[model samples]
Target chain A: MATALNKPDRTLDQRGLLCPLPVINTNKAIQELKPGQILEVLATDPGSKPDFDAWSKSRGHKILSVSQEQGPPKVFRFFIQRSG
Target chain B: MVLATEQLQEAAKQGFKKKLVIVVSKGTIDMLYPAFVLATTAPAMGIEVDLYFTFWGLRVLTKKGVKSAKIGAVGNPGIPMPNLMGVLPGMTAMTTKMMKKRIEKYWPSVPDMIKMIKESGGRIHACSPTMGFMGVDEKDLIPEVDDIVGASTFLGWASDPEAITLFI
Candidate 1:
């Protein structure tokens, strides 16, 4: 069920992967989506938020939102829209 | 005139793409990991990346050398062992195995990182002088190498005004 402003066309789970892998994989994953589609990323790396922020800016993509899930492992969630 | 100047500045900012040029000169597992990490990550960020592997770092471009890379325990202040103990037989191997085990749990291997770098359109350049000095022919290099280049060529690539050059 996709919601307005919160729906993602694709989701990438990067748990257990460290710095650079998450960013690298996210770059790869975003390439598969059509322009303006959103990608949901679920990552366990504490560094993902800033990495995604910088990545989205440099690539001209937009990060719709970033939130954290407070689990024992602490997951970071990012909804990013592909640039045209 | 002010409006025209602002437009020019805006255009320049939008048109400039970031570039990263790294010179990797050590072959130790400890040394190579950081180099490969940056090499792979830069391309993912839409930054052009060029890695110039020279001296011992040329080993990483070789099939056998990449697989047999070891962490040097001798004279390494970071390792807990004293210099005398570090020089003991089998110490380097033991240290290498321990380090490899830890690294494998959290990161991709050197060869895998190289593959990812290539897949992301990063350039891997082998130093021609090192290849000749070490008696390593083109056949010894892994398939990912883009070219064998001299210092002048690598320096030319690094000379881009916006390129961030690093020695690792």
Candidate 2:
């Protein structure tokens, strides 16, 4: 689905954060958003990938996409849809 | 029998819930098993799991220590020994080593579990406090650790209301 329609209602800046931090912060951000709101997560931690996937599945939230910036300070960009 | 659209929607609504976690610290040897076993399995079950090694808990995550881990015995109050075995006097460090060797034969090693945690997308961290306390350089910690962090940093993750925090 084109989650591009919505400007992310929330932004989770998890740069330099690891593992559970990204997941935890993402969860908290989603809690603060309204139904159908979007959350954008920016992280440098490699562990975010699995944590994000697991979180999305268990929560029934939609993951729009994960875009990686390949370089020093590599970035993982998560565009997410908060559903039921 | 074909279900109605409403029934299908209801079934979808009843789907499994999301599992969210902030931190898991295995503070002792006996405490190590449950935390990592769940960590490796929880993601497959759709839970977001992270293992944060701190204090002596880091013992489980470090590769070198696993081979030489001492099992507590003979009135060793600190080690988590079974009640019956606690009174046994001959179980010294050497005996601990032997016991560890026998147990390792039956199960996945720390390295194996750490790999699973990483491949399955879980995260691992070594506590900075413990590292400093033990005068352990970052190089001494398990290679699986993504980084070294203090308690405040760890707390940031657990601050989320939806996150479950555990001290193993």
lDDT of 2 by residue, A1-84 (tens): 564634787788988764554675677678788878889999987767766776676566888888899968899889988886
- In the range B1-168, model 1's lDDT, one tens digit per residue, is 344334433444789767789999999999999988888888776678899999999998998998888999887898877878987899999999999999989888888888888888899999999999999999999999999999899889888876889999
lDDT of 1 by residue, A26-61 (tens): 998999999989899999988788778767766778
Q: What DockQ was computed for model 1?
A: 0.44
Identify the runs in model 2 with alpha carbons over 4 angstroms from their true place: A1-84, B1-28, B75-90, B93-106
What TM-score would every model get versus the actual structure?
A: 0.90, 0.51
Q: How would you class the docking of model 1?
A: acceptable
For every prediction, compared with the true complex, DockQ reads 0.44, 0.03
lDDT winner among the candidates?
1
- Which regions of candidate 1 fall more than 4 Å away from where they truly are? B1-13
Per-residue alpha-carbon lDDT of model 2 for B41-157, expressed as tens digits? 555445566667776777665667644445566555654556566565675654466656765654455567678778878888878878887777876667778888888877777
Per model, state how many residue pairs clash. Answer: 0, 2
lDDT of 1 at B150: 98
